[model samples]
Target: MGNLDKDILEKIDDWLSSSYDEETRASVQKLIDDQAETELIDSFYKDLEFGTGGLRGIMGVGSNRMNKYTIGKATQGLSNYLIKQFPNQEIKVAVSYDSRNNSQSFGQLVAQVFAANGIKVYLFNELRPTPMLSFAIRHFGCKSGVMLTASHNPKEYNGYKAYWNDGSQLTAPHDKNVIDEVNAIASVKDIRFEGNTQNIIPVGEEIDPIYIEANKALSIHPEAVQAQKDLKIVYSPIHGTGITIVPKMLASWGFENVTVVTEQATPDGNFPTVIYPNPEEEDAMALAKKKGEEIDADLVLATDPDADRVGIAVKNSQGQFQLLNGNQIGSLLIYYVLSAKSDLKQLGNNPYIVKTIVTSNLQADIANHYHVAHYETLTGFKYIGELMTKLGDSAQYLAGGEESYGYLVGDLVRDKDAPNSCAFLAEMTAYFKSKGKTVYEVLLDIYQEFGCYQEKLISLTKKGKAGAEEIQAMMAGLRQNLPTTLGGIEVKEIRDYELSQTTDMKTGRKSEITLPKSDVLQFITVDGDVISARPSGTEPKIKFYCSVKGTLHDKSDYLSLQNTLEEKVDRMMKDIVG
Candidate 1:
């Protein structure tokens, strides 16, 4: 503690003397007395700034933490921004939280802040999914909304995701503008802490049926789902908000043999079943997969804490249950929607699909096969949502997703909708099953049509301040020393997203990239393989996305080609990162 900088000491002292509660002050004092220098500095070094995911951080008592004061200050800042954005009108916001520690309390505090600022607040009576919160904002026609959950992060963390009236998360100008308002608050005294009870409306189950019905309408093949109504489906909420509505939504979708993973059906912030609540991880989906095997289920679905992301396990050609990666699941969903629409001759005018730049290009190929348009955005669902909003009623949005288990079916909810995706995914499985085929066999068939593509994601986490600096240095090094080849293949071109240009290695020709500028770099080999590198917006890590493709002319050749592709991805990753 004595080694702490003078400014840090001042910040700590201010917390002790300010209107901070006794418990918070005593916790800071204990850190000082215990000579916890690292913890103190880590806790007081800086405020948690908004990123692609809004305000998120470890839950504790500090400016850098996701505590009451921080959440309150953020909400107040949002209130100020909303007032300025829509002047002289009654400002309204929908508020909800996930099943995380202190999530409900933080949500209540946010609602109170908005209410105290003379804004109308529609607060959920209990914990709910982030997608539902997004839907509520649009359905109620509110000015904005906020969801309190750390997403798939560890239990020690909590976060706030602010959304606009379109039900999408904040984008440019608004995101930074809200932060500017937050930075203007010099003290906790500046925040409107007092609540206007009348403005704070407690909303309950009345909105549930409306949201469920909207999701039910996303089904494209209702007749097929009805035919295979007993499609042995297993679901696990991963101890998050999905339990609130996912099961009911499945029932609404006409799935009769749905088995909710009994061990993890409840919404608990502790997330005791798995180390990480994210369905993207294999461990998190273990229970669901086990139940799928025991019950001989056709599909297994697990949603993250906020229900924005989902992971599934389907039987492979070997009759063994395997957890499909985000790219696989996303491709399956895209193929299902496009193929169905094409067969039904219902390919709406200007129908299009969207995916992140880091996702597999197989989606683009599938969309092309059906003569549907496909677009790519930066690696965040917010950007996808922004594009959907930008397109509006002009273009029909079929589906969109990222490689992180986040996916969306219809345009109704502007975020990745787990329950909706589950319904659609289950329908996909059932559709193929009705044709005497499994989803896995259908996936192989897809590879047969469009060349087989395998993708790999490697994330190197760098935690704390020093780790952050290390990540920055790593990115700099990557940019400075551009590789000329990968996996023994000549690098044909380089696409530097930060510079918003693509440079051809052979001719040194340059072309401007149209998407928003981001600190990402891509290497395209002469053989059409692609590898991208970018730092994560929400967490302290840098990630590399490698995709390699090969032709699969026969079903029996699937495993052989996939194995070779896996090796190719491994070599490419080693060459890029090492």
Candidate 2:
């Protein structure tokens, strides 16, 4: 305790004296007696902030951790904000949890807090996908919702995603206001722990069918699905929530030959199969890939713990299984949706699609080809959902996705829906199979039409408080000393999202960037290469996204051109990030 900071010691003392539970106090005392300086500092250095998305952190007995007390405080604050926002009206909220270690308990605590505060609660009986939680918000006419899952984070971490009435995460004023409310609670005693059993309701059986039916309705080619019903598809949930609904949705979509990777079929918080349950990682999909190889499957799909994002593997030109990046998958999904809508004459006026700023520009080109308007938002899926709500009736939302293996079709749910994406992916595979082609073949065809766009994301992880400062300093250094040239190409323009301005390097003319202010910088080169530098909002890392475009006159030139682009990206990353 002598080595600990004076302020941190005081905070620990407060926790010991406060109305915290006996277990929490004992844990705090043990840390103090054991002189666990690092753990003490990390756990109580600062309060776990309720950011725009909500709280996420390692689970422990600390103010900065995800625990019963922290969860209760967040819920009570949300309860207060809801009552203020919806005065006199009956306030309703839905709660759902993933297969994380204490996600179910935290979710129940959140529901109890809402119920204790006189707000009606509709809680899922078991683990469900995060998108279904979003769907339940609208399905049950609830004013808000909470999803308990760390979403692709490691086993030690957990999170809470707060949703609004429109089935989207909180944005703008609500996000800030909720943060304010959460910060106002001074002590644990301020939280209401007792739940009103009458106000708390169990909701799964009735909501599941409606949600599955909604996803099933998004299918465009029922005939193609019937014709290619035996399309061999391998799927794994990676011991997450996807197992609850993915197979059921696929089967309902007429996929008769779906094979589940039984080893990873059960939902487990420990994620026993992989290092990270994220579908984006190749190692996480190894089991599913093995299953696919055994069955000679047409496609392999895997979803993260919350089932909000999906990663896919398909046979390449050499007949070897290759994992398609998020951009490739998003481009294919949008392309399929747009082309099918056009073929069916469903391209109504004001047809639009959405993608994040870091996503591939190929989506914009595809939207242009089909004459559909495309919008780019900030990095989070909530921003896409916010755009959907803002465009309520004036524009038709065909589909939207990000470069993080998340896609949504027909705007049924405001958040990313992996189960829905899986269904549509299989359907798209079936449709292509009817044409004697594979999804990979369709992707190559797309590149052949629109210039091949290659994108790479390099993330540098920096852990602990010092790492956070290092990340900030890195961003600051780049901002202060802007790069004039990258990979021997002249930097044509610089878009400083934090400053909300774009400066032309040659002309020195400045123009305002109309997007919301964020800590991101983009360098546009004369050769049409775009390099974006932004720190991850949810993780302890900074990411550099590089995209290069080149003409693919012939399919044979694909590999050579891809190699050239990759070399260029490596050079650019070294020049800028180093």
Candidate 3:
């Protein structure tokens, strides 16, 4: 065997000869007997690191992969932490999963492990979305929660997302604390694999209606929905868990002319229609787009596999259906909410909003126009959730979103929710229609009013050990030598999140940024361009976000202005890396 193969085999041998269960041993032995060299190697490469997002990897038999044992170990660690953290309190955890191949099984394993540790477990009877799991954690007043999902990743992948009592993913000391607990586990023998049947409660049917009713009350422009009840909309779930509640959420919202994409409607773990199964990908929304074209629908919407994020399509000025990036959707939602509720007498003047640093600044610009305070957090929605918890009682949060199609309307749930976003996006369509406008027209007007804000994201995937080392080197190089300029504009400010320092180029003054330490670098150009570089904590990739903005004189300049901004983004990318 090759050196790499020998290393993998040694890891597998350790698991086989160690204290693993009979079934796990038998599975590994079967791979050995069948001479499945590639499978064995892939499975034993390394243990899956429990990052802030939780555990995620291809489902298989390995110490590092996503399987019953891995899930159990993670739950055991989390359980230990919960017991220690809340010694005097009753420890309860909510568990839910998506429509992936082994999602339900993994979720059950988690519940069983938690229950074995004397913690109460509220488990979903069937596959559910991730957002509900976030909501359930807070709704049930649980200490922590777990969701079995990989978000928009392909079928081969599965994951676990851990949440604290605030309904947000762990941050700062908590994230590190959980990781330490998980690593302290020496072997499978450390896990409490035995489960208590009594503590495991099936919670789907009881919770579904409660979630729908709560969401319905969050609508700000119900009058528009009442007026335009027959608003034409096309939706697709891309063969995931969205079908479970999206249509139901819309029906509850009083949308009557909704058309479901039949071929892509069902809940299938394999995701037969698209290779990526991410709504952000055009190919994944093919059926939805086709249906929109055939019916001449007003708008099209699609959700990722786990239903945490959503993508949209609207009729552009040329009468052609075009996909709206995350920034566009985020901006439109904020605009609709602010403009509609500005006249609401009951609404308070202390209304606040949120978006990630990577999200388009158009949101901040819009909020400024309405005199609302918009906060910027780290890339993850969990940070947005953290802000909500920190500012509880002190400030009223209106909404928050990121550039990856994830959004949260109201504080009902502490995570990015597609069901809520779907309902609101449809309502926004109706609200615009009531003013003799389409959703597309509202977008154009927003651009005209707030300057045409353009943003682009580029991700570079570097796989395996060598890739990891290369990415580290790239980050180190950037930190050591800051770029002087980008897109022909002087770099005025540099924020290194890892160091929590922001340096002004003109005065050479450094100030502390009050946020958790993260490995991110952002540069603000002299001409109002914002460029941020970040490496994914969960995936083996690095992402660069370029944002540029300019005033639009009229509707005729929209396309040309868009193209000019695209060119500026290209030049910025080359300057930063080349």
| Collision count of model 1 | 0
Candidate 3 C-alpha lDDT tens digits along 100-183: 888888888899899999999999998888899988998999989999998887788899999999889888778888988998
Tens digit per residue, CA lDDT, model 1, 1-578: 46678878888989998589899999999988888888888888887776645798889877888898999999888898999989999988999999999999999999889999999999999988899999999988899999998899888889999999899999887888988888898899899988899998888999888999988877888988999999999999999999989988989989999999988988888999998898978899999999999999999999999998999999988789999999999999999999998999988989999999889999999999899999999988999999999999999999989999989987988999988898899999989998999998888888899889999889898877777899999989999999999989999999999999999999999999998889999999999999999998877789999999999988898888889999999999999988
Instruction: Give the number of colliding residue pairs in candidate 3.
Output: 0
Model 3 / residue 476 / CA error / Å: 2.1
List of clashing residue pairs for candidate 3: none
Question: What lDDT score is found at residue 257 in candidate 1?
Answer: 93
lDDT of each: 0.91, 0.93, 0.88
Which order, best to worst by lDDT? 2, 1, 3
Order the candidate numbers by TM-score, best to worst.
2, 1, 3
Say which prediction, candidate 1 or candidate 3, comes out ahead on TM-score: 1
TM-score of each: 0.98, 0.99, 0.96
TM-score of decoy 3:
0.96
lDDT of 3 at 131: 93
- State residue 223's C-alpha deviation in candidate 3, in Å: 1.6
Query: Relative to the unseen true structure, what is the C-alpha lDDT of residue 529 in candidate 2, on a scale of 0 to 100?
Result: 92
Query: Residue 97 in model 1: shift from native, Å?
Result: 0.4
Which runs in model 3 stand beyond 4 Å of their true positions?
5-10, 26-42
